[model samples]
Target: MGQLCLVAVMVGALTLALYVDAGRQAEQNAMERMRSLAASLAVNPFVIDAVQSPNPTALLQPYAVDVMDSAHADFVTIMQTDRTRFTHRYPSEIGGTFAGSIDDALAGRTVNQMQDGPLGPTIRGIAPIYSNDGRIVAVVSTGVTVENNNSQLLERLPLIIAIAATLLAGGAIVAVGLRRYLQRVTFGRGPEEIGQMYAFYDAVLHSIDDGMLLLSPGGELVLHNDRAAELLGLTLREGVSAEHSAATGQLPSELVSLLASGKTVENEVVLVGDRVLLVSQRAARTGGKAGSSLGTLVILRDRTDLRKLSSELDTVHTMADALRSQTHEHANRLHTMVTLVELGKGDEAVRFATDDLAQGQRLTDRVMESVDEPVLSALLVGKTAQADERGIELSIVTEGRIPSGLIDVHDAVTILGNLIDNALDAVAEQASPDDRWVEIELIASATELVLTVIDGGPGLRGVSPDDILRRGYTSKPGNGFGRGVGLALVTQAVRRSRGTLSVQDRATASEGARFTVVLPITSDANLNGNTAPVTPTPDRKAPQ
Candidate 1:
């Protein structure tokens, strides 16, 4: 609307200017024409001779009338030097005094002016007529009437209207086009609404804990919040147009490539150094789905802490499962003893109880003697029970005693528990009971710790080891929410401890997978300043 109004005003102003110029030009043309006609008549020999005659009015009147008719002038007058008319349109006034000033004509000069006469307002030109001896004898005046000039001006009305219409049409077209463009880009929002939305956007961008980045379609850094800068370790300034690659060149190559590709991504877990970030990328557009593209929006959520907590929760759940199995087994044994006592077989009952106790104690002793860390020990016990319940043989082998505080308990549990769980899931799919077996080897040295898990199931033949370790690479079928993050978390923990991981086909089995992880066990492994030894007691509460 504003644009239209402005265009309208401009068109009107231009039309008015043209109209004023036309009027001025018309008046100028009329004045020039009248002056030339009067000057020519003043020098006519017939008029000069007649003015010198004893009776000038009779001689000049008819000739003056003929000249007026031929020249198409409104009125032509011939008067003496004393300003007495000799010839006029009104014969009765021919001898009368002229009604307008003739002082310039007496001074032997020509004159042109607008004056009111018997014919009303007119543009008249007066000139002095000279005798043969150069003496001023009479004066001649000719004029174009104001009404006739106005009629001539009215003749150009159609042209003025045409020009004005063209201007109006062009202005309206441009104004409407501009308005439509603004409507699309601004989503039909007014200036006030756009301002309000910008304010809200600014507040939300800085206030959110997650990192947000807006990139241009040409891979330029359009905007990013403080959190995004902090997460990506960027030093950015407002209004600087930095190329996307140069701005984020210090980041992981995979992440930078993903951003540069401008593809739509959702909930992609990317590891940046030791940080586990959940990233999502989406296209930013001006309108709906069919609208023009603005750029891409990349949102980053730090999941490092969440992943750690989740791994710890898995460990706790494993312990709970182990305790439940222990409780159930103890109850069954007690029931058996009660039955024996009721049936008067006390000696047999004692022998049966001693055998069960020895079996449980021996397994516990073996686990404690190998790995003295409470969390790993407890995790192994839970996983063993879980495997036994599924009719799979689980074995734990250790090269040396792995004492407590060699590494973080949480990290150890995350690495060992996720590995064991994956192994169990693998061997559980075997059709033959004898083929379903998993072996864990723990080797602890002065400088490093190595953990290996082997499962008798389908080996990773078609997939690369690096590919399987990436987040969201899972072959097992489930709800798929958390199926693929285990190995990724293991890899993250291993990298945080400056470790290396390897996956291959099991050497002892024809069809099985083996995963081995080596982590530094020295003080250099404490990369996050968490060198303090983890307490031996495990947190038993379930994660909420």
Candidate 2:
């Protein structure tokens, strides 16, 4: 519509300009013709001879009338060099002075000007009549009155109007066609509506908590939300290809591969820097199911905190299972003691109860002596009961005692708890339950905390130590939601604490895997002589 209106205005202006130019040109041509006629009359012998006659008006007046009719002039006048009229179209005005400038004509020049005369306003021309001796003898003037010029222009007014109307009609048609084309291109939306939709969509895209990515079919990034850039730790710019993104080493190579593959991926766990993201991707189609694919939509949900919470939940479940097992074991022990007393074997019952109490007390004392952190002590006790229920021997060996306030409970549980659970799983895989045994060692000093877990099971089978810590990399496979994040979580906790984790496979002795973690303990005044909780940095790089 705007285009249409603009075109209309332009066409109207052009038409007006054309009309004005044409009218000006016509008026100029009329003036030039009058000037030429006047000069021609001044050069005529009859007018020059009459101007010198004793009775000039009789000879020139009739001649002037004849010239006016032939040249289509409004009036013709013959005047002397002294401005006295020799002949005039009005006979009564003969012998009177002309009413317009004759100084140029008297000075022997031909000229034209617009002036008011006896008849009215006119475009008049004057030319000098010179004798053979080169002296001005008379002046001849010709004019076209303003009224007559306007009548001539009026005769062509209809044609000018017709052209203008035609042009206006053509412009209107073109404008209407252009307006329809614009409407089709814009999906029938007005400018205001389109602007509103753009603003709404932009707000919604950035407002989401999860990261969103839109990619072309060729794997070029089309759009990305703010959260996507924040989560991935990369400045996302539009039109960058997946290959280029991977080359920067900021985005994970695995994620790039998935994007380039153009295949649908669901709930796939991917490690981007130090953050774990649950990534889902689908091909974006233009229309329905059979429509062509336009691009791919990728969503990244931050699972770092969620995975930690899941790890904590797993610990809670393990503790509950251990408690249930302990309760059952205590019931059996009570039954045995009751039967012994009822069968008249009071000494045997006493010895049986004494040995049971002694073993339980020993395990509790070992855990208490090794770990001063209540969380770690409680975790180890729960593991002991779990190991006992599985008929596996669990031992806690301490070379140096861990002090209270030296570690965050969550971090300690995540690292050591996951390690013990993985060992337990390895030991449980053994065919001989009697041979299943796990050992844990805790060593702490003023500077560092060291933990080690070893199991009596088949070793890593030449698996790389780094490979075991990769998320979703597991030998024992089952379709479980939280199956393979244990070692990965352990690695994350260790790294956050600025610690080191090492895995040793004893392929010869014991044929088991040994895992060790060393965490540095900081004793700053701000921390009140306690170990500061390890917090992951925003730009921390994850292990490859």
Per-residue lDDT tens digits for candidate 2, residues 73-149, read: 98898888778887777888888889988888887788988999888999998899998788898888899988888
Q: How many clashes would you count in candidate 2?
A: 0
Q: How many Å off is the CA of 85 in candidate 2?
A: 10
Q: Candidate 1, residues 332-434: lDDT per residue as tens digits?
A: 8899999999999999999999999998788889889767678888888888888877778887776666777877887888788888888888878878776
Q: For candidate 1, give the lDDT.
A: 0.80
Query: What RMSD, rounded to one decimal, does every model reach?
Result: 8.7, 7.9
Report the C-alpha displacement of residue 200, candidate 1, in angstroms.
1.7
lDDT of 2 at 215: 89
